[model samples]
Target: MPGRIDARLQELGLTLPVAAKPIANYVPTVRTGNLLVVSGQVPMRDGVIAYTGKLGAGVGMDDAQAAAQLCLVNVLAQAKAALDGDLDRVVRVVRLGGFIACLPEFTAMAMAMNGASDLAVAVFGEAGRHARSTIGVPALPGDAAVEVEAIFEVA
Candidate 1:
């Protein structure tokens, strides 16, 4: 049977993609004690980076937000893999770290990150309310418009 989180995803018309392989030597996730730390995920879909370019440049606010949401979906995919496909093992969403690739003039990092935050809450309800840090950078891996990493407390 599907878990609550899976059902929620279905209801929202969101489907987690296959977890992407690490581009470098680092693993996708690490579990220590009760916490699972997921590496930063870009907006990859169909085996390629779906959203690229810097915000305030070619990437618009809508696409940036979509990229953030996609990154969160990838993060959840990694977390599910780490927890042996049982997202219900997740006890709490501890934190989310967002990186927005943007030009120097861009200042909407927090608003862009809300794409991921809102979905996190939508999927996990109160358990998804988490501490977060959003940063603006000149570039990110694969030049993705947005990247998101997560710390999950699991059973």
Candidate 2:
């Protein structure tokens, strides 16, 4: 039988991709005390950089939103790995940090990040509601349109 969270994911048609290995010195996830910190995850899917380019230059609002959602999926992947596949152990989504790659004049960073926030709520219910910071960046690793990192309080 699938875990409760896994079932929820299924119902939403979301399949968490395998956690991406750290490309540099940092680990993908770090657990300290009751908190798990997942490193920034780009919009990677099926082992490819699924979304790339600056939001205001070429990427549309909807695509950037999807990219944000994908980044959070990777975040959950890391969290699952850190918890030995037990996503139900997640107690709360404490915080989320969103980085949006966009032109200097762009101002819709918050709307783009709403993609991840909406999914978080769908997956964790009230516990997924979290404090968040969203910022516009000139660039990101792999030229991905969006990156999202998370702090999760877990059992």
For each candidate, give its TM-score against the true structure.
0.98, 0.98
On lDDT, the candidate that comes out on top is: 2
Q: Candidate 2 on 21-139: residue-level lDDT in tens?
A: 99999999889999999999999988899999998899999999999999999999999999999999999999999999999999999999999999999999999999999999999
- How far does residue 87 in candidate 1 sit from its true spot (Å)? 0.4
- Candidate 2 least-lDDT 10 residues: 13-22
Off by over 4 Å in 2: none
Q: Residue 13 of candidate 2: its Cα lDDT?
A: 96
Superposed Cα deviation of residue 142, candidate 1 (Å) = 1.1
